[model samples]
Target: MSYELKSAGALSGGTCCYAGSRLPVRGPKRDLDSPYIAFLGGTEVFGRFVKTPLSDVSESLLKMPCVNFAGVNAGLDTFASDQALQSVARSSEISVLQLLGAQNISNRYYRVHPRRNDRFLQAQPPLKELFPEVDYTEFHFNKHLLSSLQARSEERFAEVRRHLQEVWITRMQEVITTLEGRVLMLWVRYDLKGSAAFNHEPVLVDRSMVSALLGSTMGLVEVDVATAGIEGDFDGMIMGELDFPAAQHMLGPKEHARIGCALAEKLQGLI
Candidate 1:
């Protein structure tokens, strides 16, 4: 179970851009001439410091090509806004959509970069009006903006959270509809806060919100990374000094394996 950790920069697959897609995705890009399954989402789907992602693991078990279209720090909006990437994913046999956090996407209060959903574009009038006393220029990331807003006032932060949750549901549905095929939903989290909890991964998304979107998906594969006991387990991951902080928060090989197996099980008869 003990594997040597290497530098994150040493990973083999570099990102590549498809002809029509605007965003660069994790590479070892597949030839689209043949049928293949597409796995879509953010950092976890991209596998970060982990060598083999769930997409690769599932490919080995299913005996088919699984194209990983995820990017580091990517989120739902990254795909939701990309018509080209959506076209590429729509053509796949099925697309595995990772249920990333709600805060990364654009809402009434703020805007995120279309390609990199984690990047905060600019706060809208609503946000400026809500947090009139706070200087918006200081925020360059969605999490930073959200955290600052929360720190300002919990009562006001609830309003922002509610707006994000609503927008997330609508945006997810649009993405699912845009994909227009067997779209499997994957939920990998370190906690089950019962309600929309910010401290948990898939930040600000709760069971009820997922339930609202469930009918649109092929099915849902929910994994509690902590319950599976992979929260603090960082063995098998390769990272350098800069990669350490993020790597620590990311799920490792064992966790990805468990997720891959669960996803493959849900994917059994579909593909």
Candidate 2:
């Protein structure tokens, strides 16, 4: 919710703003005015304990200037807001917007929690809390025992997922239309229990919708491998779970660097 800005003025004379709950950067001034390679994403792109930070990834990868606009606990809803859009419109030379899972987007459609005073706080609520009458467990497959089966059922799970996906698509379309400069979408998946919880379904939806939106615009770049293959070793890079030091939203610094570097390569081509 609270953000602190640090600038790397000594080295690049450019500022680097780092925000979020903890591990706030104390090194550099975030070069808000200068042309930069911007990374937009949720908590992962925010880089929980990333020693170098996602913004700094370009320094190693492309030797270019970059900044991070990712807000903690942020979803597509937050990105689609006037304030978020304005932030994108006002700054940076190139932008990378990471689209999260469809289920995570669905969670934002209904009001389920109280409002917080923060830049990340949009006016929407959690899906579960908004419709108490409807079983929230169905939506939150992570906690439900019958989650796997329920999600597999075409009649029940697929129907709800379809509606949520529609909302996701609409918001993505808005993002495509609004941001100026070269824009790329990194389709990051939601890691539940160190596994690919939503499968490739949400990633597919994001890719398809993003492609459609890009057809209308010229500067949109797409990042594949947003969702990691679950069968592979996922010991370190998993997003959720307490294995991480503090919050469930991110992983260790090592993973952040890896993700950051990988992302920088993708952004390097566009910028």
Candidate 3:
């Protein structure tokens, strides 16, 4: 389970574009003037640790230029605020947007950093009033703050969950509407898991929730790669000695290839 440690610099080959983006994106820099496919999502879409991500593999399979606009720990708010990234997505013939965890987004109760959606910026009055004794300022990330809140009182945390889901749907709708081309919703999950519980990421949102959020014109592509075949194969896929603990859970090269093929097949039908 050892991978050739390739830093972001090495994989990107010292060529990254930041023209309309807050962060540097993976690139040889494809021409935006011509036809291309845009891939938008969180860390998985960015293909952290893995040498080849879905965008690169899909580009080879479909014979089209693919732009990777995904940001690590990105949420709907990240896309909603970035006009430059939005323009790139609008210009593409088709855009594949990964279904990121709803928890990373901001809601009426709290706010997240615009660029790094996972970082907890501040708590709104409602959240403060709910847990007046808890010092929210001590927290740095959304997951940690929410986990602590839930531990204090499940009833109060229920309200937080409700607000997050509502905001997630609203922000997602707003983001999807701005895209000009055919947008395909790509749901790439480890597996179909349990209900949304406290102390865990909001990785699984209800299908009905997603269906209601997206417009009728959009397409849905669900890829669950938690099968026995690929579940234990992470040898060369994950980058070793990473600071982030979450990098260990990322999908390997085999899963990325599978997802790429599935995306290619789905795109063929749409195009």
lDDT of each: 0.82, 0.49, 0.74
Pick the lDDT winner. 1
What is the C-alpha lDDT profile of model 1 across 113-159, one tens digit per residue? 88788889888998888889988888888887888889889999989
TM-score versus the correct structure, for each prediction? 0.91, 0.61, 0.88
lDDT of 3 by residue, 176-219 (tens): 88885368988876642334243223353668777885664368
For model 3, the superposed segments whose C-alpha errors exceed 4 Å read 6-8, 191-204, 226-230, 235-246
Q: For residues 43-161, what per-residue lDDT tens digits would candidate 2 score against the true structure?
A: 56665533455556555777776666665455565556545444644466667776665444434433321111012112234433433345443432322312443444546555455
Cα RMSD for candidates in order: 3.0, 8.2, 3.1
Model 3 gets an lDDT of: 0.74
lDDT score for candidate 1 against the true structure: 0.82
True lDDT of residue 211, candidate 2: 66
**TM-score between candidate 1 and the true structure:** 0.91
What's the candidate order when arranged by decreasing TM-score? 1, 3, 2
